[model samples]
Target chain A: MNSIHDMGGMHGFGRVEREVNEPVFHAPWEGRVMALYRALGFLQFWTIDGGRAAIESLPPQTYLTASYYARWLMGLERSLARSGIVGADEIAAGRSLRPARSHPHIMTASDVANLQRGNFERPTASPARFKPGERVRTLNLNPETHTRLPRYARDKEGLVEAVHGCHVFPDTAAIGAGENPQWLYTVVFTGRQLWGADADPTLSVSIEAFEPYLAPV
Target chain B: MGDDHKHDHEHPDHSQLGEMQARVRALESILTEKGYVDRSTLDLIVDTYETKVGPRNGARIVARSWTDPEFKARLLSDATAAANSLGFPNPVGAHLIAVENTPQTHNLVVCTLCSCYPWEVLGLPPVWYKSAPYRSRAVIEPRAVLAEFGVELPENTRIRVWDSTAETRFLVLPMRPPGTEGWSEQRLADLVTRDSMIGAGLVRGP
Candidate 1:
């Protein structure tokens, strides 16, 4: 989706302010929200890609105004409500309306360490379609739903730098379209190719593109 | 509106903050009551990232690479295994690739689509790294962004920005500062800041 969150090339947001000594969470609520967001992942209601897409799907106004964790809280709420785990009134009234639905054994203390660190790669029987040093072009896609393809690199020509093994594709997985695993490649696009004549000739940008997004140039 | 009424206008700000805090508290309690989350375990995870695990892990790796040629070779060639060899397993989606910053080339990293950082190695990302400004401008004007972070490269040096569109996270192996030939790993690690490894800043002179 071409949302506000696809902030690859647009500008004028101002300087990157550096804090002298930054804490992990600026406020106590930030910590709680972060924990809730992570804890919700244990339910397997949505993929990590889904969580991100929810955040990206926020209204442009909310995306611009909300704090970092506020965005996380919103995404969590969205996932919960959409999945039927929690109702809208329950969230608004600050209480669960009914007995908790039976879930995959509620993640225990012992399970916290290994959560989300498991292998996301899905085995593929086919060999890679493109090899290193091969020229390829990114598909110019503009979808209305969740997509990992940033707007900046759409339709750009690049060289395959390296081929990573097949992994769960986020473009489909985020929207409940299945893993749709595909070969991933590190494609190198010159700055000029991406940004045009004003860009430095020697500079380059490498993007990890899914197989479906690329084609022989 | 009078001078003495300025405080009245600020009252809503405090109430708004209080409401947000109440909302977060409410959500936490509901999740706890439903058995979806354990408060203590959640605290444990947050505390681990807050205090125990951080850029220090990545710093040590960078310092070791700076001092050991064999380790550096492994780091550049195969970073995931190199990280594992040093007791730092590549976590989850983080298939790290260490890009060396030479006198001629510089490297910068950004996840334009999302904030996909190497959490196991570099720990939780900083607020700025996850900010809208950094995400938008890092790829569009990396030199300008780096300049704001106080990193200024020569005009002739090429800047390579790695947009982490997938699981392969990048770590910038910033060039060793001049006059640090025999520095111990411990001392070398001190010079490597979190930003240096992220390619936003350079290692300061010791």
Candidate 2:
């Protein structure tokens, strides 16, 4: 999905606004929204990729206008309705009208205390196709489903700086497909290659490209 | 157009803020009623990010790297393991990669696709980090972005922009400022600002 969310190199946006002494959460509800997002992870209703995809699926207007957490709130609603955990009508009415669905896991205070990040690395029998210092070109892919390949890096040539081993492929993991693990690499592209000859000579861009997104140049 | 300054905040409109509050409240109540999430757990999650986990964790890591050569090597070699050794684990399905700033090169981190940050170490990302301007221009015009953040590197210094497009997260290890040779690790940690670690600003000399 080449949505507004894939904003890397597109212009017309103004200068970056830096807030002084910014609070973690602007409002109490902001904190609550974040908490809900974290807590719902225990349910395993959606993958992290799926959650991101939901946010990306937002209308371009809504995606551009909504705040960060507000986007999360909207994405949460979208996921909840899609998963049948909650319905749009129930959300609009501010109450639960349907019978509560049972989840295998419900986050408790104890679960919160012992929370740790999920590890995505998996064992693979196949060797990596590309090695460090190898020249590769990113595939020009424009999939409608969730994809980690940003529009800016599509069809760009880069050098593999490091091999990140086998990890869950987001393109599959995002859309309820299995975690088709792929070898990830740190591909470095010159600013001139990504943008144009007018780009700064002193600048370079590196992205983590899954093996599927790359081919030997 | 006149209300451009309002773009500084995530939620600028009062009505929109109120609507978000109500929507979040409604969602929370529904989830609780459905027995999917407990209120106490939600409270604990918020408290953890608010009080415990944050840039202080990353700051300690940076300060340790500055003081301890062996630890710095480990951080540069295997950042995920080094972060976990300091009790700052990477977020779900993510790896931590610490890029060092030197006399000739600088590193900046961004997720142009989404706001994929190392939450365990840095906590939630700031609003500007997830903003469109920073996301769109950070990779293409990093020197300009750095200038906005008051970080003007020498013209000869190379800028390496890490767009965290996968499960990898980047932390910029700013060069230790001079004139603080004998400073305590704690004192050095005090100089590690979030912006410096994000490569948007330089660690100021005391």
lDDT of 1: 0.82
Q: Which of the numbered candidates is closest to the native, going by highest lDDT? A: 2
Clashing pairs in 1: none
**Which residue segments of model 2 deviate by more than 4 Å?**
B1-13, B88-94
Best by TM-score: 2
- I-RMSD for candidate 1: 5.3
Collision pairs in model 2: none
- DockQ agreement of candidate 2 with the native complex: 0.67
Fnat per predicted structure, each in turn: 0.62, 0.81
Clashes of 1: 0
Predictions' DockQ, in order: 0.46, 0.67
